[model samples]
Target: MAMAAPAMRMASSASFLPRLLPPTVFSTARAQFLVRQLSLPLFPNFNIAIPVGISLGLPSLPEVLEGIWEGILKAVPKKKTSHMKKRHRQMAGKALKDVTALCVCPACGGMKRMHYVCPTCASTHPADIFSLAPTPSTLISSSGSSSLRIHDTTSPTYPLAQTITNAHKLGCHHLATARGPQTGNIFASVGFGGDVKIWRQNPDSKEYELQWDLPTVSDAGKGDVWAIALSADENFLACTTSDGRIHVWDLAAKEKIQTYETGGGRGAAGGGGSFAMAVDLSRDGRLTASGHENGGVYVFNNDAGRMVYSLSGLAKPVRAVAFSPGCKRLAAAGNAGIIALYDMEHGEHVGNLSAPGNRPSWITSLDWNDTGDYLLSGQLDGKVKVWDVARGACVATHSETDSALWCVRWLPPTERALGPGMGKGERFCAAGASRSLSFYREATGI
Candidate 1:
């Protein structure tokens, strides 16, 4: 009995020894494995930030080795995880863009993701775009569901304050908002169904109330309204039709005032007629310019009711046209991937503004700042450029997206402030084939 007890005690002791030995072996193996993993990649040269895993492991090294490293190099205190979130919030606050969201595409029935084209519909028009009124508080935009929307920019997130649905039976194509305190809130929009509607914000209701709607064509055929423009005082509304005819309407009397033709009522597709691809009203309300699919540009005098200038310059379809805030110069861009600036007073062509190493991508849009000092341009290749008009050079370049740009505009400086730093609050909106609106602000220019 005594021998058996001793043997049992020996067996129990032997089993305890095996358990202790395994723990030591297992710990060694784990330590070796972790060291190998750390040695594999010290750090990646990621531009924005470091990976999270490496940041955590950096503090767990042995203290003895830390002293040896401290003598050879200085160590920066590791960044706290909470600090990352705080820094990001700071950046977003200073960003020129505040609110960005996609407008659901009526054609494709989907959202336009960044850079990627629409997956469902083949149409290329931007989903929703806000045409900021010359005034600071008002904005107008087009939607995919045959609707036109207007927003109040005073809100921090720029919420949609009004929506005009069924404005166009087919769909609304473009929107234009007038400048000035009194005229700023009043705007006009044209739809695919050949109708132009005018909206005014009712002071009593604080809502956009439909003041007038003009049916451009007799029959609501497929060939409908193509483009629209509103004069500075919001008195005269100019609209172009698919039949290549320009119709001018007087809002004060609610009557068709005049009609201008482009010689032939034939447009690009021969649907109704191609009168104009794009149009714009001069800041002074004296001159009106129209771009045609055949790459023709014409400026007419509203008072004279006659074509004053048949500009001979660009040969490709013109997509965008703008008059400098001063009304001295006209800038136009289109499929040729070039912007042609015209001296309206002299009735002569000014020099073209294009970069020397510039690629031959389609120049889809052009906009001049209020002072006419800088011009903002967007292209089909997803490049945004700010041009110095006096120097005739590109001062800054911003790449927003690759989709074709439909429109670009400089947010006018506010009444409270003007100059470089005053624009800290200035933001511009861009919309195009991407079915979304993008906001950008000038990075602090030293």
Candidate 2:
């Protein structure tokens, strides 16, 4: 009876145990308890006792294990994320805002998006740049605009140093600077309005000012002047006319000293000779060369005052002509897309620089580096090429833009005014239909 009484009490006290065990376990225990009660006679030795002061609010095993797993997870270190990755993730769902508003370009009257470069207007000029001339410290650019802009090339930015507004009312087409030691102080420009203006740099202030303009009486002999070149000493100037006449001016006397006629009196009867599209004066002032629209390249003896050589080989219009610094070779290129090299002394077609393809882009401009070992050319298809004059091969080519390139020139090798020493190798600048100027430097292995 005592055992039976304790067993009854233990069974009643077990009501609080359901909190510790799951419902399924509690139900199974209850079923086992009923079976033991019914079989008490078979298990009379079994004893039941209620544990005193036991807590009933303890967690189940599964919940205790789950809490342990959570602690382990909290203690584990997290992977680090880079700032770039975080930025990409944060911007993943965002879209770029579009600029929809348009405005008129003040310079060219062309429409463009606000705060954007005008498609019709060139970098700083309202029209296409026609010529580029480099001094030791500055780069002079003449566009179809009335303004002539000078940029400081010593600095990497090539900042605009000065702007001569309305220098050419009808817009200038060609600019010429002396190539030797006496350069930078004096330069010349020919405008579309048939006027050639001389500009001289101030020795102290370093600012350029108008020296003089060509007299109108000179134009009576020949039509509009199209191109001009300066003598190495800056003492003389050579200009070409639309009627195939090459005129030399003594700048000091401000008088037309000599005139070489390529038109052979045909221009007087209104039948102009093939228009003189390009002209150059040899550095020694011994030779004057002109390239005409009819692919005739003529080299005149400046000392003898007559034509020396009538060069041939190119069948298309000649647009650009340049004499080597040593006066040994002359390079001429134009619509034919081939550069013709001529021996200046013998007036022989020495070689040609051309690509192997059937169709080639027209070469518009050409310049020789100071050493005369390399030649640079700009093409109508927006390509700039550097040629090894000795090897007769194109060494490098750059096609930064697909717009027509009108002018390209090599900056004279000089100590950078902003730096410690002279530039390592050759450097050049190009400008054209993009309305912007691009500068390139030779790649060095150092």
Candidate 3:
């Protein structure tokens, strides 16, 4: 009986053998076999019975291994990535494009990225463009470089029609062309060195040639000339000087014909009069108007050979002045950023044209359309505005750059207008510190 007791203990201890072995290496069948082998050897007379099925109070090897694999799978993602999530991950850390980084193309009249070479047109001057003048069929541009460039306005590409190399040794600042018929054959340019050169188009070849240069010594008080204007007949040239004197020269005789002084006898050494910044002649060749640095506008009767009116109202330096085609109204603007309209007949302050803003940009240049219905103005803030003269309101505004605008001009109407608003044939060009000329056409629904 004592031997049988030891066998019972052995069998009871065998039940825990499965728990001691690794779950992968242990099984229910192996547990039963071990118990039987140990019990039968200890007591042959005792009836040793081993259960076919045994419970170790734990999961089996196969069941435990499967449960462990399922837990590992739950730790990882199961669903496929969505399209939206994948796109977001791909686009992360990228910057959005700016909406205002665009401008109007000068050639094709389309939109393009600002400061980038336009795909439609890739034309530019080597240096800053300071002045722009338009003839009936050509557009002339002068820059800080010593060359004068002429572009064919009649062509879409604005192809370079002519290039006058070494036209000015010290760069050109101002250029003037006749505004009416019988004057397209001649033009004038003022250089930084204070010399005025006249160019005449050849009658047979249709090319411009340097006709003559005004001797600097012949100027009033030996002062430098700044602005110039030509008469409709192309027979007379009027120019402003640093000594606050306006001189009229007869081109046919090649001599100074008339001298109108604004300095009131204050010699050139006595701080002369305020510098005359701009000048223009009436279409009929009857009136001459000049704008000065002291914000003074003066009108003279060329026939009477005397000062007609000393205009007022502008408090800042005057930079530009123009007479309406009809010769009834005069428009002037300057650092004040406002356009003052004066009645030419009575020399009375009529009205003002200004945009809505607290600090408006300095007006650099002004021009009237052929019909005198609209006025075109270029500003230092890189803005060009068209004001309706009748309504005294700005009709259109264009901002294609952030650089200063030095000059703007309305291109003469062509026989066959091509772009939008062709029925009206209204087109204009602007140039400035950008060193490129930008052309814009009136927008129309068509």
Candidate 4:
């Protein structure tokens, strides 16, 4: 009776305990099996059967609980995450994205992404074209070096056609070439050694030969010759002097023709020292213009053999002066960065083109395209800007290098096909301290 009572009580206790658990994990079948196992004898009698896990000495209930408690202890938090560590995790997804930048090329009229070159044209130069002169087949470039490199303008590659070794004994700083309808195959180079020498292509050898030299003692001495220009006929040469005198020589006769003096030249007492730095003869061989260190620009009439217009408004050293193809307008700029436009007919200050509210480096060189439509200016910041004459607006800007650009010039118009969608617009070249020549084609080209 006592055994029956204890078994009945144990059975009641087991049944009641199962009711306390949720039914999902421990179903009715599982509760019944667990109760059957719990009702078994604590120890085995003789030859009694035991479950395989118990006979194999599997872990006891208390030992299993102790292992679980140890696992929980191992999972405890170690340390707080740092702010920087959290930030890195947060930014991981947002950091993976492409940055697309775009730029419209001034020369090719092609739209391209920034930080890339034009896909159509491949132009390069060995040295800066300190003074660029157009020729029949290529461009003659002179830098601070003695070698004069001729670049083929017809091909997009701008291959080097000829190199005049030791063209200037002391390194040529300026080069001038003219092969227009009125001019023959003649070019001029002025060197730092203080001498001027004219060259012509030898018909038989197809190489340039020294044709003439200027008298000097010293060429780089008092009233030193600073800049030179040649007329379309190649018969007249104009050069600037430190004393602010522009001397014209008849190249054919090798005689001094006329000298245009700025009233502010060193010859005048209390007159601001005039240092003529740049000179250019009109394409028609009618006018001569010179820029001076005294911020003065002078236009001289070739036929009249006198000064015509003395332009102002620069108030700073004028580094570059250029005339329009039609000989009607003149463009001048220099240390002031503001490009001053003047009328050759009325000799009046017509307009000015400048970037407002921005710090500008010195304007080193200027060239007017053959069409007289766009004016290209290269600055010390290694940036080239194309200014529209009609609208007086900066149309395109190329910022390729951070070095100073010494010169820039427009290439002659050509109908030759370079590549698809290329060769339709005006093209120009720029060179400077970077020692690499860069050519940009106007998107207007075919």
TM match of model 1 to true structure:
0.66
- How well does each candidate superpose onto the true structure, as a TM-score? 0.66, 0.70, 0.73, 0.70
Error of 1 at 129 (Å): 4.2
Misplaced by over 4 Å in model 3 are 1-123, 264-271, 419-424
For each of the candidates, give the backbone clash count. 10, 2, 0, 10
1-446, model 4: which lDDT tens digit per residue?
95676657665755565464422332344444555566555312212233333322123445457758988998998999898877797689634444456666555677754433444443333455577777756778787777887777666556566888888766777777653643438988888877888998888876678899887564333466779888877888898877787889898999888978687653332343488889999988899999988788999898998988888889999999999889889999999988999999899999999976577789999888877888999998999999999999999999877798998888776667754556566678787887767777767666
Sort by TM-score, best first. Answer: 3, 2, 4, 1
What residue runs in model 1 are displaced by over 4 Å at the alpha carbon?
A: 1-134, 219-223, 265-274, 357-359, 415-425
Q: Which residue pairs clash in candidate 2?
A: 122-435, 123-435
Worst 10 residues of 4 by lDDT: 42-51
Measured over all alpha carbons after superposition, the RMSD of each candidate to the real structure, in angstroms, is 16.5, 17.6, 15.0, 15.1
Which 10-residue window of candidate 2 scores lowest in summed lDDT?
A: 49-58
Rank all candidate structures by their lDDT, best first, as comma-separated numbers: 3, 2, 4, 1
Clashing pairs in 4: 107-441, 107-442, 107-443, 108-441, 108-443, 109-443, 424-445, 424-446, 425-444, 425-445
Residue range 43-132, candidate 1, lDDT tens digits: 222112233333222223354366568765656566576867777877878535533545454444567543232445333233544233
Residue range 29-93, candidate 2, lDDT tens digits: 44455445644664477644424443334344566577589889998999988888867866884
> Which residue pairs come into collision in candidate 3?
none
